[model samples]
Every structure is written in C-alpha cells, then in structure tokens.
Target: MKTSLIKLTLPLAAAGLLAACAGGPQPPDWQLEAKGSMDRSVAAYMEGNSRVEMAELERARTQLTRSGRADLLATAELLHCATRVASLVVDEPCTGFEKLRPDATEAQRAYADYLQGKVQPQGIPLLPESQRAAAAGNAGALQGIADPLSKLVAAGVMLQTGKASPEVITQAIDTSSAQGWRRPLLAWLGVQLRRAEQGGDTQAADRLRRRIELTQGISAAARPLTPVTKP
Candidate 1:
C-alpha cells in the first residue's frame, strides 16, 4: 500500500510542476490591466476626448511595460506617438514605431504611414506605393483603407502632392466636417483655402473663408468657458 501511494503521488507532483512551468491558466494581472486600459484609450479617442485618450494611453503604456509584454508595449507606444502627432504636439518623436511587429494589422500599418508622411511630406518615401498612387488622385487608393481617418489622410496626401482636384478635396473635407472631426476638417480647409488663393480663385477663396469662420465659431461655442477666479 505504501509503494502504491508513493507511485500515485509522483505523477501528480510532476503534472503540477509542468503546469507551473506553463505559466498557469490565468494571464498575469498586468496583461489584463494593460488590455483594459488600451481598450478604454481607443474608445476615448474615437469619442474625440483627447485628454482622456492621452491619459488612458499613458496608463496602458505603463501597464504593458510592467507586464513585460513586448508586442502590446510596442502597440501602445505606436498609438501614443500617433496621437501626439495628430494633435500637432511638437518635439515628441515617434519612438518604437519602426519596431512594430511584422504582422501588424492594416490599420496599424496605415496609421504609421500617415504619421511618416505628415512628419516629412517632401522626403519620407515610406508610404506604400499603392497609397502614394492614391495620393495622386486615383480613387482606387481609397478602396484599400476601411478606416475613415486613414482615408482622410490619404486624401490629404493627394492634396499636398498637388494631384487631387478641388472637387475631390472638397468632398473629403465635407465628409470630415460631417463626422465632427474638427481638427482634420480645419486643417484640410486651410489647405484648400490656400490653394484657392494661390490660383486666384477669389470666389472659391471667399467661400472657404466663410466656412472656416463658421466652423471656428461652432467649435468655440462647444467649448466651456473658464470661470474667472479672484486672487
């Protein structure tokens, strides 16, 4: 009976050891924390809450780094950098983006390209050939991008390259404005307004000026006025 008991215990002990080596059934706490934070950050960004998005992204970065999850860490870093770039925050380099996983999703890859193009429109040759071609006013380029923001960026690229027609860019700007994407809408309007002026299209330029003023007024109205405090 004693020998049989020892034999039964030995296999159970080995199995337990193997399970421990496998890192157990549940994920580490930090990984779960990081994933939750990332989801919230993305949600905040989509809702256009820049302050909340940045804060959540910073939390995700910290949690991912603590978890030693390199893939997630890289993704978080890329998102953080991309947000900063979109907000026109100067001096913040897009670090760890080049180290993104080879199998990164299409959205991730597209965003990286957009950032690179924005940073060095005249010199960076990193954007995909197909996207570059799209920037040259090929409607086909728009087909590959499913994300609205990416499509908008692609259209902006076309405008910057002097390859898109006024009608094409105006359509893009209108779409962004309808979606309440104020930043991109304003930026695209500024670009088209400048183009109209340079071409001596006084009528088109005046229309763009009025649109800019109206958009700015709407934005200002949406913002809460700060209360004055007495010293």
Candidate 2:
C-alpha cells in the first residue's frame, strides 16, 4: 500500500510546484483564519463521508463571506480545487461536487464560464495546478485541486497546538518555496510528515530526508506547523 501510494505520487510529486493566485489584497486576518479553518473542516468532510453536509459548506461560505470581505476570486479557486479532488476520493463519486460546491460568486462567475468549456478572451492561466499535474497524482497536482489557503489550515492547526516553532516553520516554507514550490507546500509537508509517521514507514521517512536535503548537507528544515493563535 505504501509503495502503491508512492507510485501514485512519484511522477506527480517529483516536480514540486506550488500554486499562486494573481496579485491582489489579501483578505483580513480574521478572514484568513476563517478560510484556514474551513480547510481542516473540509479534510474531515472528505475523509469521513466523502462530502460535507450542505450546512457545513454553508457555514464555511458564511464565514468566508463575513466582514464584507468575500474573496470570490479565492472562492472560485477553492471550488475548482474541491471539484478536482472529488475525483481522488475513492469513497466519493464526483456526483454532487459540481452542485455541492459553494455557489460561485459574481467575480468567480467569469472563471466558471471558462471552466464550463468556455474560453476567456484573456490568455491568463486559469488552470495552473491541473496543467502542472496532468500525467500524475502528486500533491503538486492536488495543488490545483485544493485551495492554496487550505494548506494553511493544517499548518495553522499544528501551530495552534504548540507542536511547532514559527521561526523554523517559516524557514521550512522559505526553503521549499525558494525551490519553486508554492508557500502552501510548507503546510502540506506537515500533513505528509504526519502521514508517514502514522504509517511507520522508515523508507518514506528517509525519502523525506533525501527530498529535503540541500547542497549544504543539512536536512530540509521542517518545523511542526504550530499555530500562534487560539482555536
């Protein structure tokens, strides 16, 4: 099973790409927290029932919309990711994902038109993540499927529990991003490490070392995704 999982990830993960949103003002800190929270809730939603209840999605949508700070651009990106990841969960068919996805906001409508087989006049890359992972099922592939902010959820959760150092954590993110990965990979790295530890795979653990080691002969600096704020 470990080998099976790795095989699935090898081609996809090998590239180590990260997703980036077009430049814009970031949502407020509170919105950031809400968006981050929604992500963890989403994982639980996916891991258990394969889909979240409409109520749950509504709550997330509500939180995201609060403060008059709705980020439709980010929301559409989130839905795009959710739609794609729906294909990955073996337990869940991608049935209602299209409908179940939080309604796309007006700003996101343009994006939807493009996704629904329509072409926008502009040549912007609306499908970076999918384009990056076309032939593989690596996390980088999922980078397109999952919201970049969603990655912060795991890291935030870890940080909240005091399991990691913010400084070292920041370093970990910097190290990976300098290599052409997105900032979110820092958080996903947290999830991946936890997965390896739980599965008790030394080989996988060693793989982390080989993957993270740099020209300096030091292992990739990974700190637990410890959150500084309260839950």
Q: Could you say which candidate leads in lDDT?
A: 1
For candidate 2, give the lDDT of residue 19: 16
What's the true lDDT of residue 179 in model 1?
A: 61
Report the alpha-carbon TM-score of model 1 versus the true structure.
0.56
Q: Each prediction's Cα lDDT score? A: 0.52, 0.35
Task: Please give the lDDT score at residue 128 for candidate 1.
Answer: 42
lDDT of 1 at 154: 58
RMSD of each: 15.2, 15.5
- Candidate 2 vs. true structure, TM-score: 0.31
- Which residue pairs in candidate 1 collide? none
Report the C-alpha lDDT of model 1 over 1-231, residue by residue, as the tens digit: 000111111121222211322467666566556556765665455334567767877886787567454544555655555434332332455666666646444444554555544424432333444355563456556556544544555565555445556665666677567666555566667767778788899999899888877766664534422111100
Per-model TM-score versus the true fold: 0.56, 0.31
User: Model 2 off-target regions past 4 Å?
Assistant: 1-29, 50-55, 73-77, 88-124, 129-231
